[model samples]
Target: MRTYQLYLIDDEFASHYFGKERMVYQLFKDYKEAVGEYKKILEKQIDFILKPIQEIKIHQFISQYLQKNKDFYTNNGLYYLEIGKRSTAKLEIHERCLMLKANGNYEAETIFFEVLRKTESSFIAIDLEHQRCGWLKPIKERKFV
Candidate 1:
């Protein structure tokens, strides 16, 4: 038998669920109260009404987070080591589109990921196999009329 707990595997997943990656599983300082609530949720026993947690805009939090993570700010590039066959293509495409839109502001927006088999390659070996799969434009099929 195996057990599993809900854990966002990466920044992308966290970003999708919690509005931002930096918001991953933080304690509310009142450890007992927070854990109590969590346990209740798991046990389906939360009876007492609790105040709603206020929501902060993801953009605002992302700004603060990126400031702290200077490397992420400086890099300004998204990478995909592998395009999993079972992965959610729509989500990946959404992330890439966001990056592409921000290209004007950052000027280094690119989704650099490896193709099948090869760990890396020269610039000439572009992975056009899935160009239409997760980009702003259709893969290499621009009309020239």
Candidate 2:
């Protein structure tokens, strides 16, 4: 049986929940406490930390999964792939409209919209004069059409 572990960290507190085992481990009250527990676990279970599993953004997971694997409502269109050590891919403007048109799959659309909204919110939160006019302009201009 496949098992999954969910580590929740909020306000420096940490809690671990195991899906298959149906076990909850509240190991720490803060990051400091969590670090101590992690160190202790590291001595015995170093292999567990190196396991391969998908780490996804909560908002983008659904759309990403569907798009990549199932091709759910995804049309043949140009997409933007960020270049760097930590690269990211995003649908272009035409791709966005195609996704919007495919309302038949509401779940995928909903997830994509949520991801879009979050990205837009973060972009809007930036300092306009410094970030938008200076840094973002060149990046936006370089975007793939």
Q: Pick the candidate with the highest TM-score.
A: 2
lDDT by residue for model 1 over 1-145, one digit each (tens)? 1111111123223223332212322221122245656755632321121112112322343344344432233223322222233221110122111221221221222222211102111111111222221212212333598
CA lDDT, candidate 1, residue 17: 30
Candidate 2, 57-85: lDDT as tens digits: 43254456445543333345433332332
Q: State the weakest 10-residue window (summed lDDT) of model 2.
A: 132-141
Q: Which candidate number maximizes lDDT?
A: 2
TM-score (all chains, Cα) for each model: 0.17, 0.22
Give the Cα lDDT of each candidate. 0.23, 0.28
RMSD list, candidates in order? 19.9, 18.4
